[model samples]
Target chain A: MNSLKPFSLLKRIRERLDLQIALAILCLATAFLFVGGYLNYLRAQEQERTGVITMVREMVAVVEGNAAIAAYLQDLQLATEISAGLQSSRYISMVSIDIDGGGLVSTGAVQSGRSPDFVLELASPFSAAETVGSIKVYADLDYIEKLAASKGRSVVSGQLALLLLVSVAILWAVRVVVTRPLGSVVRQLKKINLSDEGSINQISTRSQDEIGYLADNINSMLSAIHAAYLSEAEQSRRIAQLERKFRLIFEGSHAGIVMVDGQNRLSLANQAFQSLVAHLDPHLDQQEPRPLSQLFYDPELVEGILSTVRENNASVFRDLKLAGEQEVWVRSLFSLIESQNSAEMGYIEVVFSDISDRALIEKHFEYGATHDQLTGLLNRRGGEARFRRQVEQAQSRAGSFVLCLIDLNDFKPVNDIYGHEAGDVVLKEISLRLKSALRADDVIVRWGGDEFVVSMLAQSSDAVDAVGRNLLSVFEQPVEIRPEVWVRVGGSIGIATSDRVGFSIERMVEAADEAMYIVKKGDKNSYQVFGDSVARSQSQA
Target chain B: MNWMIKAVWILLAFSGSLYAGDILVVVSKDSPVDTITKRELVDLYMGRSHSLPDGSPVMKIDAPVDSPVRAEFYQALIGMKVSEVNAYWARLMFTGRATPPMSVTKPEDVAGLLARNPSALGYLPEDSENEQLKTIFVIKEDQGAP
Candidate 1:
């Protein structure tokens, strides 16, 4: 089974809140029915017991009445006549007369040896002058037993039927009150598409319950997310603008732009820094932000430059030497730019203009440092800095977002079997496909080789899935590097959503990378959402 | 004329034999074997029982299912109609505890069954019995004997 995506499941449940509520109601109703049935059963049993006891008591009363009459008859002078008269009564089973001291003077035709299962009563009577005799009567219990049994059976059956009906009604009621509503909510939640810019705002719940309150909260959260996304988008646009402006400034300026902070950290190294150091280091393009100490071979020369900048607190122009064996001409100008926030001294801007014949070569190296050689995608360092700035802007706005790490599935095989030239063509084709699949707001950076990083200002996971699927579909067709040899490769994509995975770019990338591996393991042509088990496994391994 | 006279004489002789046969109470063979005097039998079949002097289990049986004799027997003893006996049995059977006495389709079947089982007892025509069955007690046609 595909590993459960908890966020997707949560989304689905939220959409169908009505169904969940209805189910809960149904369960509650069922419970009520059971309890009601049990109570009815208990009531019936109690009634049956009481009825039986009453029947028995009534039988006893009949027996006692017969016994009293029999006793009264025995006291009379005409005991036999009275006994004979009592015999006329149809219900009397037996009648016996006994003297005060004598046992059983006379008994009716009924036998007496067997134990009496019927109700029996004995009573004595007294004459005016003296106590006479006693009499006993038996009242058959079979009739009472029959009556009670029939009544109990009917009552219990009736009660059981009532309980069954009530249970069904309660269950139906629960379904209507809870399950149906919950199902509606769940259906709505299922329709939520986080990838759509305005989709989150469309969620509407009209209930006055806790679910309604939750829906309202979710709506506000979506608004917050949308606002954040817009702000982040604006920030990215600004960063691009700044990068363009910086590129123009670096290339167009006659004076070299070398920007350094108080910590000796190089902020920006324009064309002049490269020119000044090119002769001393012919491979100056490879030496990025070379420390002032590394640039100067003599430690005393570096100390002089540092002291001039520290003491003057203004522009300090000085002539510096090539750091190593190759002697080069360099002019260094240092000026402190005011800190954007506090007046505490900020980084010093150093301008190094090369007035040497190597200036043309250094200019070429500077262009290569910032620009990507292949596909024109941002290089690793440039992409990282841009991504960090974007993340900061995104964090300030608290927007819903996604980060995707994409790797070509079969790019390695293409390079191994077909050659680097064919592999490069495939990579370019993949880059074009990725660019076409993304929105203008999204950023696609070729991290290097076969890997690309994409950042989207999407509102939901579904948006990420859509973009991933689009990229996958675009790559599905085989690329014809030549008329003869066709290169077929797939892309493995991992997507991490900001809302679920949080707002950290590194974490998002990690999750996406993991998710991408999942795509590779499960379906090479598909995309996997990060932090959704499939992706995490790739990260873990 | 002579044949008609002879037929009349035969009829007279048959009637005379029936009248002299003592009108004994006959019970079916499947009846509960009870030895009851005329008064006691009258009381039992009439649904009257003060007590049992002999304390023997008593059950009463009637003639064939639709026989007029059965109807007359219940009327004379219990002062109730044959239908009343039927209704009584229906009520008794409805309780599901007790069953009415076993019935026979014919008086002869009753006699044959009674002759085979000692526990079987029934009042039959006085002259109809053979030596196989015993008559412990007799119920006179009239209430003259106790």
Candidate 2:
């Protein structure tokens, strides 16, 4: 691992921007230099060759006159001397002079008739136009070529050096101008912490080139990202705070709040909701989500509310009577919490509040409205309501009931002798005795100031007379108004059977009242049957 | 304009020396050669040939190296300066094949030498009082003239 680390570092350095740019420039420059240097070498070679040719021409011109005189004389000795002189030059490989009609004088090794580089026709010494002989100077071609090649190589070498220097300079300039600043900007970006309250640091560059422009754009982008991040954080903070507030409302409410899933199982419940369920079923303490229906005594009531709320997408209000010895009543609201996404089902949110106190108060008001405050029995209004219900039952079943209407005899004289308070005491004592005489299911009413009514289900006329005799015995006993002050008040009784008068309570009461008045005119404190009185009257007529 | 005429007169005087000459090619009075052509005379003195035009062998004579008459004789014959003529002969001296004319070292010794040998050839100024030799050819400033 240790040995490989430097190799990895070297690889990373090779991948650096400055080194990569330098390598690219070096490759391109080397290619162009190769091409340009080759062209320059060819040009130099050609120029040097031309220069060598010109030098050889000048050498031939220098010795032309001497060669001509020797040719004209045809002196073999003089010709040989001139050839030797010309051969001394490095550019001349061989010199040969051919004298007309004479032998040829030569210097250096004469090859197999090789053509000379330069040929001059010699003129006679005394005449300008006379043709004498020819002088041939063979130029050293190998030496000339070598000279030209050396010159061309020197020129190409100079160009290559210049190209290398320029490439190095360009690589340095690019690193300074572009790559280093970009690396600095990247490092600055990495250092930025968006969560901090401080502003993002901007990259500093003096040059007004593209790198500076890039720094400006990056700064703007960083600020934008930072701003977005900050706002998102603040929004989440507010959402959490709002969630806490809603949680307080849920937990601190007097009303029980419960959230149940679509499967009728409890998903969430506040403390109040759990307490309310504890009242219904105190032993229920399993942690796993139990069915919300099990929390209610009447599961059907909860099912009805859930169905109604689900159908209407609205709230349902119901008063539930929980089953227990304690008269526990609850007002419940079940609302459908709509699902935000279409794919999921809605939840049912229920709120339950204990209304038992209010229910008991309402029951008291109802009892006070129907019963008589003085005697604790059904009053005239209450008796009429009962009488109508009894008539309805008798008609529906084809059964018979006897209605008795009773009025006290000489009760006003007792009220005149004793005070009204003493009259109330006598009335209370009579009501107790009347209640004791009849069956518990019998309907009794205080019909007027001195009139009392009793209704009992009867099947025959003998049963009707038996109830009439029992009610008359209630008034036979005297009620003691105060200590040692007693009042004896007899009641005149008139009995009517439902079979004779049909199921109309008003008709039955009228028939009984007329019989009681007849009893009051004849014998006070006696009993009379409504139909029997009519028969008795007819017998007398 | 006066200076210009002076310059022209100067120029004419210099040109008169270049074009006019007085030299004569001669031999012994008793020799067969008389009134020789310039070409045959050139061949004898310049060493292209050792014989006269008639094909008889002959000896050639010349004035001393420093003599003004010798300078004029060769100048009128070949249109060359004295130094140029010496260089031309020096080239032939290397070959040992052709030789230049024999010199007498004194202008007075040329007549004696020519009188001793009939086949001898020599040259002198045209006004020279030498009865021992005869004029074979007249040399002039223009060597091309016939």
Candidate 3:
């Protein structure tokens, strides 16, 4: 069976190439042989025809003088004798001579319809130049043509036989030397499995001709194919291993990782990213892709980050608050994922790390920086910030507010008589009274020992006067400094309105202090407003 | 005595060379033919015409086939050997186209035959000519030697 396989392959190759070559050679050689043989037959036939004519002409030549003598003598008997002698040749059908006196002497036939093949002008036997008569010899054309045709057939057949022999010899040589070797090479090639490296085998040939060169070429080509296949297989194996390593990293990481396409839609989300998204909106449909922007509390913030990433091809890190039932914070890193092919649209890689605990601690620090410890209200630093905000609100609303500076009139004498603890108890009682008397949105601050500053929105002079009366009544009742002792400390108050002081906090406090000095000089425990006359005297002072 | 015989033999050879000269075609002096050309003589002997150009009917005679004069005469006249000339005549005679001329055995008999008929044509050696036969045409051996 194995031997038969090679033979079948050989037959297939032979059927395609070798058979065609042999058939082409046979067809071409046969056409040329027939044409050449036909031309040769024509030449031989012509030669045979000319041979018969030549023989008849030579026979006529031999009997020419006798016929001429007979013509000269006007002798019918001698003319008959000459004609009879010429008629003895097989190629001559009839012979005749014309006597000088216009008499005709013929042998075999008196008249023949066809033209004569040979005509000899009979001159006088005695005198060389005298025209005596003519003798015409008719050739046997039928017999001569038959002879020539037979000769032509023999020559053509011999040539045809020779052409056939040469064609067959060439066909046999081609089959032996060319097709058989090539077929064996093809059979060996079919057995090769290129994926199993080193399966390529060299073609074997014994001849040192063109067939040997062909085998060498085929072997080299097979080696090249095998090498290409081996490289391809190795490359695919390496790529699969690398893909598996990347998948492990993506699944195992704690940080949320997402790949977003050009449209800002999430293409691939790792388990960490999915969990982060679930924390943001537990009811979110995981089956359908959601826009990366919807995960943020502010879509505008997300869009700003995305635009920056597109323009710079750089990473943007922002601690963004996610939109959800509970406040979830994440530090998202937005970076461009570059496409390997320049023609493809790029993607973005986002990494989200939860940072809500850090955010809560930072908020506490922010609140501590702005509040007072002892009063549980805004300190001077905190009050300055509050006053600036109040000023901004007043300017925007086109309204006015009052700033009051209060100094205790008898606080120093009481402090010396009752000691420091009793003075502290008095200040605490006054602070509690101030708190109870003012509105909830008022700004109150302890300026220094025995001094206080308060601010409240007031749009009219009447409203300012009413607030002044309300502040003076806080010292109307004396405070119990100890369990059994009572002490009264009256407050001398001065007020400045924001419209009169022009929006500067320091200038407003200075104007109120000047007003309080005036009030202390006039009434020991009362309130005074810095009117246009006081502002004019102060500017003059 | 042997030298005298050798001299006599040399004399005979010299005379033989002299005899190989010319042959004259002749007719009897009593006939009316004064002169003839080679063409007219050939017509008469080769049997193309039996009458002379002047219209005198004449009989023709020949020397015997083996005679030297006959060989020389035919050779000089028609560039033929005696045997070829005989063949030509044999064909003519057998077909009954024309008759060949009567032949005489000896050279002297040619003059005797020409004398018997007045209009008789014959050829003889130039030296053998006599008054009874008039020379009309001379077949020169050197000019037409064949």
Candidate 4:
């Protein structure tokens, strides 16, 4: 009883519009036919009555003289003949002749003893002074009644046939023009492929009726739906492609990236991100990131991001580090990601990169006290010294400059799978390529292993990108480390220029870092430039 | 149109006239009577009395029901419609008390039948002539008679 649901049978019938309309018409037609047939039957009864009376009257008129003669003769046989002639009428039950002097002579087909319908009498006179005898005519109703009944039956049958034919025609016409068409439309609606825009167009009947209007309205509605579906499909396809590229970048980059939901649970984390978190706490690799406070070496960054997002919606830090034996450093950017409805800030997106070896960050507080011996290029310290010199020169002299970060592709496999001797040889080969590709005014610095920073004294952003592209093209062909020992390496470069407005040395380097991440995120072995306007626009984004 | 004419004839016969002709109350030349009044004529025709004014047993001769002259005769004599006269006779006959007048479809037959039965009485067209029958009275049609 608890599981049973009540369905209304009447409601189900009411919902069928065609049945409702057809029944209404059929009921009206049946009523008209019934009334008309009944009236016709009544009229036939009257006609049969009149005809029977007229026939009996006519038969009496024909036999009047003979009946008088028979009555005068007192001849029973002659009287019987007069009565027999009336038998042909089928409506006479008896005929009688009576004379005062001669006894009554009567003859007829007697009924089963029921009263007669009517009696007719006429005087048989001997001369004018006396009526010597009389003739009596008795009429039976059976023949006229039978005839009337048959007439009624024929009328009824005719009316019924007419009603049946008319009803059949109405049903057929309705099925062809209304029910079948509507049924097809309903069936068409049932199987419509909502995803396909062309599925909206159907019902090719050309008419100016209500059904046509319905079809027209449906066609217009389908067209609108088709247009919306097409536009949405294009939008979703583009979004999926961008999302795939975004996921590839977030996962494939040397940096770690993750999203924490509004509940502070790790909603998304890629392999590099997992490894980075594992570096802080190794046991986090196989477990779901519940109680996010435990997954982090210090929960302060997440808590700060949450508090700031509650008020300002987003916050970023130049650099934050985890205290450990191997110092882990990252420059973090945080923002509150919103739901589609835009009614509330739903979650947080935190993007961070391994900036641990930015020892130049410390040197930016000092000057020129850094160098690297392995590749005879300036280390992080010298790179910061040269960057400060360029900043000061640009502010005082009002000159322009471009800063770029270049990351070596496939360097880890060469160093880890091969040996350090092969790694050193590969690094020296890249150093020689940079020397040959650059102008003498360009300052090149190897900031760390498999990382380089370059400063070109150029204001235009496009020329900076051209220089970056030239550097990438250098590594397109493999380098020869030994006799007939060939190895392939690719480079991804990020460029930024001080030519546009809002250019600080820090922002320029951050823009360059962001652009380098883009090249590594998509199809690799490419270069990208981040101009000042683009960097400023994306700072909040 | 034929039935309409018949209907008009019947109406004229039963209703006496539309301010025009009159009827001749006729009897056999040997009827042994001279004349009769309209009151006596009505009694003899309606079966209220079965005898003539001369105290002889009487028989009435009539034209057929559809005959215009017969309708006029009854209307003029007894002031009765054909259906009323037929009903009266039907009731009398059913009770075995009296029979209606002997009838012929032709007015000529009515005059001939009256000639043969001296105790019989009938009406005829005013201009009709017969050697064996005699007209005893001429009843004016209606109130407009001069």
Candidate 5:
């Protein structure tokens, strides 16, 4: 009996890839063997049948003449001799001869070949045309069975041998093509170590098969992953360094720095900010931090700053006075710090410092840049800049205004006679008179030398005319050049307005100067308004 | 012509065989053919497609399968060996074609069987004559050869 090992072996073979191909070749070989064996068996059987028939016929032919003599003479011995002769053949087991009308002779039992036996009709060897006897020869079938057995054994053995050959070949092919390469790939995978210093990031295989392609792709993927890991580590280190630098800068900066997270709670405050907050309230708790609003004079100031930050996302609160006895003035910049990815994470940072002293000096410098140093009226350069601002206001608001030029009458004579001090006092007094006489929104400028210019917003041209007439009479009462020695000096005034044609600043100033020169020429100390001058000229024309 | 008749079937098989001697063709007295040429008899025997001149189908016969007259008849008819004729009939027999003629043991029965069945045809030695059957043709031996 075969053990169960062969069945288990078949299961193992079924799991393997080579079994299907091997089985296919085995089936073909088996079919060819079966067909070839059957055909060969058939041919052998036919040759055997033919041999038996031929042997029987030859046996009958040899004893035919004697069998005829036996039939003619009624001789039994002759018939028996012929029948006994058939036993010599290997295929012939028995023979019987029956001569007609004489005797019957038989030898051996007819136990051979096919059941009905092989019979041959013997014709008497004579020209007399007589029927004598018939002969029956039995054939032996052992040769047929033997031939079939041998042929069958050869075909089965051939198929078995072929099956074995095909199986071995398929197994070798599968090992080379499938199993060995996959084992190598698995071994390579087992060798991958990310933390090892000398670990390989690529498979070394250069084969052009599918396994090779798979290995290469896996290696490239591993390389990509390793690169990504390194890049991520590098970026994290950089972020840590940057955060440390930022903390140092924040702590060491001169300005008070405060950071508030997106939740509107104070997240960070530098030493300067805490000390400044401490300066705001002397009796504050030192153990806990204060709300950012407590450092300001008013709670509304913090609210306003935060609202501005919320609305415009950034704002500047200039000259914010800290709530302290020393009256510290600070300017603060409030900014919304957004996350890098623009996600919801963000905070607000306010950097503030004491600006009280600098603000005072800046105020003084601002006044000095635009105002006359001697009379405190606007100088020519600064007055022109103000004049452009006023012109823009006029155009944007659609309000009209006039520019007036006032020149001192004979001021050079007084300067030469009184040694220039008198002319200086006269010019200062004129600018003062102009500022006092004009509306609060009006601007007065020292036009250099003995001249002064004034800008007035008026409802009618007659209002400027009235101002011009008043300036002309201002030196009527002028007397003291140096205490009791007085020199009387009047003024010539010229005016131009937006209501007139060609209303640029330069043209307006020139038109006013032209009218003033006209007044200076026709009647010194008198005034000429450009509107009235245009009317007078047109009326003359 | 008589030499050609003997060699037509027999000499073609055994090219150096002796001449056919004293072969006679016969029919029943009631047969439509009182006489037929030797070539016409051979056509009927070999199953070639020819009608008797009277449009009658032939009922051809031969001696027992082992008879010498059976051998001589096929030798004259189509040069076939006796075994060759048996194989031919065996092919035709199993397929339900023409059955081989009935067998007779005695030579005298040849004339009696023909006389009983009018369409029966057979052969006899050339020296003999039968009252019950009519001779259709004679095949003389090659006695005048060199």
Candidate 6:
């Protein structure tokens, strides 16, 4: 029952509109019927009053005329009979005789005291005659009663008929004018679909009434609301689609991307970025935020990036070494985000895009330009630059260094015998052996086809000679080109020390060349150092 | 000329007697029975107002609709005029209380209804009765004539 209470109350209220309308109509009809009935009653009463007055007046005239007739006859009994005859013929109640100054004569019925008040007077029919015996006549009001009753009934019945007809007409009119239109509006409102575009159906505006105006306004409002709803829904749908596309781009990009805030703290790092950092510095995989400074081993590099960004207010791209181990070239793009009030919110963006492959390719191009392609060593141009820089530094510091020149003795014959391809392989193998014999700081150059040079920085002339002998001993073993073929390639070496000879890089290379020719003239397997005599002889020649 | 005058006089006297003996009654067309008992006739005319003793519907008839004869008959029987009867019926019909009596203009019509409908109650001159229709009651001329 408690649960049903709300439902029942709702039902009652829902039924109230029609119920109230019906009740209002009933009340209006009842009031109209009552007013009409009362009016008809009043009309009948008025007519009855008028009829009664007229009948009384007519009865009085007849009574007066009869009195004159009675006087002319000069017979009391005959006059009485004449009055009785008139009374009976006319359906009058009574006719009476009165003497000149005294008493009454004959009467039809002994009159009751309850008789209605009447106007009495003496009269004669002739203008010039004395009043005869006065006659008292009682007015017959039965006809008035009958007339009033008939009129009252007719009026009531007529009024009732009129009321019935009018009430039906009014009820029908109200249903059409008010109820039906309102019901239609309600039904349309219920069926209105907020999702569909142009769903609002226009209501009629034919009438210039308040209801018509209200419907028009409501329809316009609904149309606006529906349009707004559809527009917002469409915008949100497009936004969702763009968001999905952005997510795909962000997640699927191969290049590592890391977003840094203005505070130099890592804000967002994509999966690629995380993997890149892990590859560059395995320690970065620890559960801690790596500062940009810490990610780069060089403080100067970090400061350069920050200063560039601060000065230019733009992005910076450079090749950077990660923790002094791995070199990753990255292009960073940064931008500032501001609020609507134009206050700087923060910096957001990506330091992304691995140009490592590009960097490797560029390194290869640089290496190709500076080094010989076959022997994997510095060419003449690169070797000259290295010799000059080393000599200049050694001269300033009173340091000693050595330069060696070697020319392969049987290289051309081996190339002519086994073809140039085997010759190239033999050259590559020789370059590998020479690199292995020398220290990392020493420079080896392929001077030309079947010719090579080596440069080494040293502390003294003895150190220079030891390094030169080690270079000469590396070619003592015969090189193997194939399983059955051992190619015994040999080269004559000539060494020159920077402090002892005191020559420029080119002059030192010329002295070493002269010494190398002496070795070749003696025996190809041996080596010689350029002494002051050889240099003087060469200068004189 | 004297004999012709005598013959016309005889004819006139006969017609006068015939009319004096005749009466008329009227009833509604939908009345169920063709004849009524004497008791039912007395009750209906006298306004005693009861159904027929045999449990049939009793319908009282009125005289000529607009004639003085209607006034006289109703007045003699029920102490009211034709106008009063109409008013009574108007009140009944308006209030949804009762149906009004039907009316016939001629005595022959009354006699015919009486012959056809057993529950029909009406008045006629005493001399108007025949084997086809039964007389329920007789009233002297002073009582009422229609």
Cα TM-score of candidate 1: 0.39
DockQ of each: 0.01, 0.35, 0.42, 0.03, 0.01, 0.01
Question: How does the DockQ of candidate 4 come out?
Answer: 0.03
C-alpha-based local distance difference test score of model 1: 0.61
Question: Per-residue alpha-carbon lDDT of model 4 for A1-541, expressed as tens digits?
Answer: 5344334545655777667766787888788877988888888887888888888878788887656645543445666667777765677767666765767766775655655454444343223334656766667667678889899889888888888888788877887788777777777777777687464656555556887789788878977887898999999999999999988887797666767776777777777767766755645445666545455457776576666775786566646665456677777777777678653346677777767654446545444346666776777877777888877776676667788898988888888877888889998888878878898767789967898888867654557646866777678778776779888888777887787534577887788788888878765677777743232111110
How would you order the candidates by lDDT, starting with the best?
A: 2, 3, 4, 5, 6, 1
Candidate 5: stretches off by over 4 Å: A1-358, A459-463, A479-487, A531-541, B1-146
lDDT of 2 by residue, B47-122 (tens): 7777888888999888888887777777666667778889998877767767888889788888788888998988
Deviation of model 2 at A248, angstroms: 18
**lDDT, candidate 5, at B18:** 33
**Which 10 successive residues of model 4 chain A have the least lDDT summed?**
A532-541
For candidate 6, what is the DockQ?
A: 0.01
The CA root-mean-square deviation of candidate 2, after full C-alpha superposition on the true structure, stands at 24.9
Whose TM-score is greatest here? 3
Tens digits of per-residue lDDT for model 2, A401-427:
788888987789888998899899988
- Top candidate when judged by DockQ against the true structure: 3
**Clashing residue pairs, backbone N/CA/C < 3 A, model 5:** A113-A139, A479-A486, B9-B78, B9-B79
List candidate 3 segments past 4 Å from native. Answer: A1-15, A108-112, A251-255, A260-291, A306-317, A323-328, A336-347, A353-541, B1-26, B29-37, B51-57, B63-76, B79-97, B105-113, B123-146
Q: Which lDDT tens digits does candidate 1 get at residues A23-106?
A: 565676667656765665566656655664455445445444333433433323334444555544544455555555434544
- Against the reference, the lDDT scores of all candidates come to 0.61, 0.80, 0.80, 0.71, 0.69, 0.66
Where in model 1 is the C-alpha error above 4 Å? A1-43, A59-66, A69-121, A127-228, A247-257, A261-290, A340-346, A357-541, B1-146
- Which residue pairs come into collision in candidate 3? A75-B97, A77-B95
User: Between prediction 3 and prediction 5, which has the larger TM-score?
Assistant: 3
- The lowest-lDDT stretch of 10 consecutive residues in candidate 6 chain A is A532-541
